[model samples]
Target: MNRESGRYKGKRIIQGGRTQVRTVLYMAMMSAMQSNPIFKATYQRLLEAGKPKKVAIIACVRKMVVILNSMLRDGTMWDENMAKN
Candidate 1:
């Protein structure tokens, strides 16, 4: 929660999720940023837009999770073009 007019007023990510999953996603995001064209482009765009590196990486990880979930639900193969669209 934000503490208005306090010395500790600042944004923070809620610390309630599974640490193991977060660690795996972070590692996967790092690899994807280097190897996947889609994620690489997104990282580059976020960097150009002045987002913090960690924030950009987390965005990519979230996007990746969404894509993976959709693919699993629909039983579709991974397609670079489809992901772009």
Candidate 2:
């Protein structure tokens, strides 16, 4: 699950990738923070467990990518109950 790494130094979280893809993923993750209860709960749990806000957000985005990949690979639609695991 450790896909992308953002190196932190001073005030920077330096990461290398397509800027557009990163930006889009960030935006989608932000939206999921509000719209998806599972993602929201995971994010809150991460924060409650002492993960940094940015780190938690990135984790959720990674979750999104994994889940989406799974769905496409299995030729199935998203299933909330399935994801609860």
Candidate 3:
């Protein structure tokens, strides 16, 4: 998953989005980091596997976006642990 996109141009990790939509997406990414076990585990695993810390975080954000998009498209509730595998 690639979180580093033109859509996120000029946006820093500490300084997130501009519009409400981007802000919401940024907040969701942060929430996925803090509260989602699967995301947390994936992050830790990536870090342990020698991926850069920032890179891992970005990957997490990208994965979160994909999952959120899928849920909204399918009209399904989020199951936070679904990505644990």
Candidate lDDT scores, in order, read 0.88, 0.88, 0.74
Off by over 4 Å in 1: 1-9
Local accuracy of candidate 2 as per-residue lDDT tens digits, 1-85: 1344576335446478788998899899999999999999999999999999998999999999999999999999989987777
TM-score of 1: 0.86
What are the models' TM-scores? 0.86, 0.82, 0.62
Error of 2 at 8 (Å): 13
Clash counts for all predictions: 0, 0, 0
Question: Which prediction has more favorable lDDT, 1 or 3?
Answer: 1
**What lDDT tens digits, residue by residue, belong to model 3 across residues 1-85?**
2346666854344545456776666567677779778888888999999987877877887788788788899888977555553
What are the per-residue Cα lDDT tens digits for candidate 1 across 1-85?
A: 3445756667656376798999999999999888899999999999999998888999899899999999999999999987885
Model 3 C-alpha lDDT versus the unseen true structure: 0.74
Q: Rank the candidates by TM-score, best first.
A: 1, 2, 3
Candidate 3 Cα deviation (angstroms), residue 49: 0.8
Error of 3 at 61 (Å): 0.6
